[model samples]
Target chain A: MREFANKYGTVLVVGGEGEKCRDVAESYGFRDVITPGDIIKANAATAPFRALTESEIKNSRDLLARGGKLSDIVVEAVFVFADSRDWASDLQIMLDIAQSKGGRLETRSENFDEGPPIYFSHNDVLWSAAHEHVRLGMGALRKIVETVFEDVTGGRKLKTHAFGKPQVSTFEFATRLLQQWRATQHGLAESEPPETVYFVGDTPESDIKGTNAMNEKSKNEWYSILVKTGVYQAGTEPKHKPRKLVDTVLDAVNHGIRREMAKLGTRKDGKGRKLPLDDAALKAISEGRTPNFDLSVDPFAKAVAQ
Target chain B: MREFANKYGTVLVVGGEGEKCRDVAESYGFRDVITPGDIIKANAATAPFRALTESEIKNSRDLLARGGKLSDIVVEAVFVFADSRDWASDLQIMLDIAQSKGGRLETRSENFDEGPPIYFSHNDVLWSAAHEHVRLGMGALRKIVETVFEDVTGGRKLKTHAFGKPQVSTFEFATRLLQQWRATQHGLAESEPPETVYFVGDTPESDIKGTNAMNEKSKNEWYSILVKTGVYQAGTEPKHKPRKLVDTVLDAVNHGIRREMAKLGTRKDGKGRKLPLDDAALKAISEGRTPNFDLSVDPFAKAVAQ
Candidate 1:
């Protein structure tokens, strides 16, 4: 984000309510951040139908008080940090900036060739929210921006970048963080990464797909386990298939431990006998069911649980 | 509009700010009209991000106060009367009604097959407004609605009907109204319509296209004249060509009258000579320019102007 600021001078930050997105950008070391609210505050007619509340007006930074005319502020790039609270106004202001002459407000580029580059944090079209059904997310707004921009610009496509789940870079960053945590807390050597990492999530399109993609590209294994209870419906086949399917996070964890234990079956007890896995437990594991018996009661189960 | 209301029990009006759209529907004799604002006021969570103002809330009809549960109010059809003031909320609510089971609120249709039909008043993608450039009209909103609906519903196309310009029915209605006015005002026989109806408009996509279409189907001529002050920019060839191109509405009218006069050259004055048009005025008319002299001063021009 700082690199964008360094390259673009003043950047426009879209999404979130009030000054939330602007604060996030400033925290990332951006010297100057202009939000749609700021643009609207400077000129109410920018998005005529959308009226800012008194609090929103108060939250907005006055472009005139900052000692610069609204037209003088040239936004070189746009960063969408979160879902837009006011999609209409945000979309309008973003489109205005994207179509403006060298990113200047109120002036349109003749061929729409000089607008700023846009970046989004994520590209999930719909996400589970407080609403009964899934709500439109930042990805949906990104799609609208591209769509409406093309409509206004006579088929010129708006190029955008996203940096969240399903993107390889995001997965790589997560893997590096996990490795650092393992070295610091679990007594694992920094050089020796985990043999296999299990990822459990309810969204097949993002969580499962991204984990599977990372597993294909990375040195260590990334086993994706898709669970019910979110975007992925129970009875339907997901577009991106996970390595394993389970009913809950607890079941997924149990399945991973049982599989690892089976792989290490060759290692026996101190008496030189195979690890004591009773027939009932073995049957339960074979049938893809969590064992009914408490793992605490058995020595082998205790070792496997650890 | 009334026909739609007669067919569908309670229609949802999905545009205009506050009660503007609802009032239009009611004036057209619609017994019940439900705007997106009403739905939002009833259930704020329906479109969580869109917040209606106090006046907007007051303008909205309360579903609970009307003696029905929110879920029980089944919207049988959707009528978009004008440009949406709140695109985000309107889009969300419209989509909710569209994806609902039999248009019932808060219930998703299993396959999105049971939603109500939608109608748009006009399909102008961009319209000249108080703003510097063309603003998004009902057509743009319609396009977004269709695009987003497909995105959310997994490729099921949204079916919509539009009534205004470019549609053959609207032109036909206008022609009938013109004929009625001619009969009453000009004393023309009811059965004998005018030989030519000059349609002067600034938009080629809607006005010019509709007039040309009417010309193709009607016995009478409908000459389309395009003006430069709106959607159609000068120097570029329009996709829908007009019969005549001019600088403004006044110029369009002058050109039409000059063409009619030239066609009527065989008509003679009381002295048994061609109807008088002086050299300068004739040169100006031939060069496709409005004569510098006022039409009120010239006998021939006075007849045409009348």
Candidate 2:
């Protein structure tokens, strides 16, 4: 994540964690993290204003004001960062803007067949939650909205750009970030990406499939490791097989390090030499604790702080 | 249609025309005619009898009736005959019955994933009306309901049985009616079907395709004649090509009769001999007029009247 932020200079963190996630990203030296709310507000600001009718204005006691040209309004794209907390209002507002001409409220689009592009951060139909049963996720909501769009358009397919696990866009973005970070850190060519990248995750369907697909598409070697934690467990067949299977997160880290060491013909096990990654750092990551690092020696962290 | 009614003991007429269509069908010797209203009423009658609460009963001034077992209610199939007039209420009632346990209103299904089968008489997304442009039809309304159902069911696909001109069910029904009429008229065995049948229609996509498919599936031979009338205009390429194309309904009938006479090796023009189908009667039928028929000779009509 630090390497990604350093490469991008200003990273945008999109998720359902709201302000807390933004604060965390800022703490990690990300300066341009934004939320769906921010996008919605920006879109609303340029909305073509509709003046209240005479009767409505009178009822409002002259507090309502409206002065804006419809021609000045244009919404480039609408993004869904995460699963909405309030679906009805969120969908209603989005539908209004979608059906509006030039992003103008109260003005219907003359060509009702088309709408602005819609993007989503994730598209999981069902996600494991604290409850006994799985909860409906962002994908389910997207399906509902798509169905509604088809209905309103009299049976036209809705166009959408969805990203997250199992989609190529997020992996492409991540690869670009890693390449930029490597170039800034080691003075390597901007076009040169990492030779080998290991992605460790528990979910086989999304995480494994995505990494495998990205590996097939990209020039760099990509390996996926599955750990028996979170949603996945041992002795069960996975939807998408990973490159390595480990009992724990620590084991997954060790497996990746051993593979790299063997490939490089330097299998000393970090006994009398400084290693790029060690047990202490790997343990900290496995425990979900941010490891302490000296920014002076850590090129990625140093670049990120700046 | 008169010939069809004279063959079938009773025909179920489902549509938006309500009592007018029912009366017309009855006049044509159709003893059993059904509509959306009839289905709605039947479903409503079986709705679980929820006892009015204390305040609600008191508010009713002792006129409210209650105390019925929910087990007594069960709706097997739901049918949509045509475009709904009161969409909100109709949708609400249908949803209630769908989510109900065994069609018991107010009782949620334990499975939460299954529902009674839904049937649609027509599935047109839009239709030409008196107003300019196309208007929402029964099919459009069905799409909206299906979307809502998916939303409520957490992305489960709705089970639907739709039948219209383009669907094979309608064509099969038409063929069965024709066969029944032929058997009664010629004193042939019930197992016997016509050696050759002619289907004349204006629309190519619906009427022609359905007839062609039915012909492929049935033992009897079927030929389609396309006429330039109603929805099908001249010079437009049809999705489903017909066996013959004619300028008018009269020409279509003449074409079919000519082919039949040729096959029988008796190619005499109608002017010198009494033809099986009189031109005057065919003309009246083409103009949508009900011609007088001898009821004593019509077994189905006599059976229906009795």
Candidate 3:
């Protein structure tokens, strides 16, 4: 985000409540951060039905007041930092900018290629909330933006870049953070990382797919464990298969620990306590087969199923 | 809409600004009309970011107060009467009703087919407005709803019915209205309908397509004359071709009149007045070829082009 400051004249930061996205962009060294609210306040006609509240208008930076004209404030890039609170206004404003000439507000480009590039923080379509079902996320907005843009532009696609979750950059950043944590918390050398990292997640499209992709690229093993909770439905074949399937996170953890113990030819702990799995389960674990067991006592699983 | 009243328990009316849609539905004899704003007011948790104004909340009908519980108020059908003011909230509410069990708010249906059916007034993806470019219409919202519904529901399609232009019923109604107008205004007998109907429109998808379809079904000739002034851009081949392509509506009318005159075998009027078209142009018109003449002087063309 800081790198965009020198490259662009002005940047449009979309999404988030009120001016939070604008503030976040400015904090990241964006010299001029214009939000959708700011644009709507500057020109009410941009989105007729979507009107900003008094406080929202006040919080928004007036582009006309600063630049003397709406066309003068040319947005050079767009950054979607969070989920859009007002999708209609945000989508309209974004499309306007995406179709504008050299990022000018009121000017339309002959070819939409003259518009600024758009970047999204993440692309999670459905995210868990306190509500019964999953709520729409930034990915849904991205999809709508692309779909509407193509419709309006007559089949021209709106290209966007995302930088979270399933993206390789996000996974690489997580790996770096894990290495730093291992050095500080576990007193392990910086050069020496774990032999295998178990990633337990319920979404096959993002979580399992990302982990499998990272595993293919990384030197150390990235063992993906799919749990029967969240987006992945039970008794259905997942699009992206994980290394192991488990009923819960606890089950995934127990499976990994048992597999590691079996490799060391051990059944009991140093305290002489028996392991959770029996000889048959231990043999299955050693053979790289998921041991069949009844572990459906997870309380949260019922809530997700409902 | 009136037809669905007695069959369905409750009908959810999505779109329109404020309570305008609800008022329109009630005027059309719909006993109970629930808007997305009403649903949001009943449960703010339904759409977290989209906050209705105090006036809007006051205008919205309280479903929980009337039914005692949110789940008790079931929406059996949905009708989109106008463009949505708030896409996010409307989409959420519509999807909730679409996925609910017997249209019950909080209950999820095992097979989404148990939910309410959706109907759209028109499926015009783009419509002319005061704005520079064409704005998104109910069709775009319909596309988005279908897309998001499929994404969330894991590939099940949302079935929707439209009642406006390009639909066979709408064309049939227009034909009936035309016959009534001819009998009442022109003093022509009801059975002695016109031999041909020239439909001049700027949109190929709806206007031209509907006229062409009506032509195939009607006893009279329904000639579709598409003008390059709105959604149909110049120099590009339209998906649905019209009988004749012209510059403006005036050109379409002139073309239709000259062709009729040629059919009557007359180049001059009754008072020795010569028609605007030459003999070669009139012959070309009779042969169904659009006369190549200068008709770009239409003032509205420049504004639409801009």
What are the per-model C-alpha RMSD values against the true structure?
5.5, 15.2, 6.5
Candidate 1 overall lDDT versus native: 0.80
Looking at model 3, give its docking quality level.
Answer: acceptable
DockQ leader: 3
The TM-score values for the models, in the order shown, are 0.86, 0.39, 0.82
Interface RMSD of candidate 2? 12.8
In candidate 2, list every pair of residues with a backbone clash: none
Best candidate according to TM-score: 1
| Displacement of the residue B277 alpha carbon in candidate 1, Å | 5.9
lDDT of 2 by residue, B41-112 (tens): 433332122222344233322111124432344555455655554343345456555665765433667555
DockQ of each: 0.43, 0.04, 0.45
**Better structure of 2 and 3 per lDDT:** 3
The lDDT of each candidate is 0.80, 0.57, 0.80
Error of 3 at B19 (Å): 2.0
Please give, for residues A1-306, the per-residue lDDT of candidate 3 as tens digits. 567767776899988877788788888888888888887787777776777888998898877777488877788899999878878778888888898998988788877778888888888777665566667778888888888888777788888878787876777888888888999997887777677888888888788889999999988898999998666767878888999999987688778876776655553445433447777876777787766666668756775688
Would candidate 2 be rated incorrect, acceptable, medium or high by CAPRI criteria? Answer: incorrect
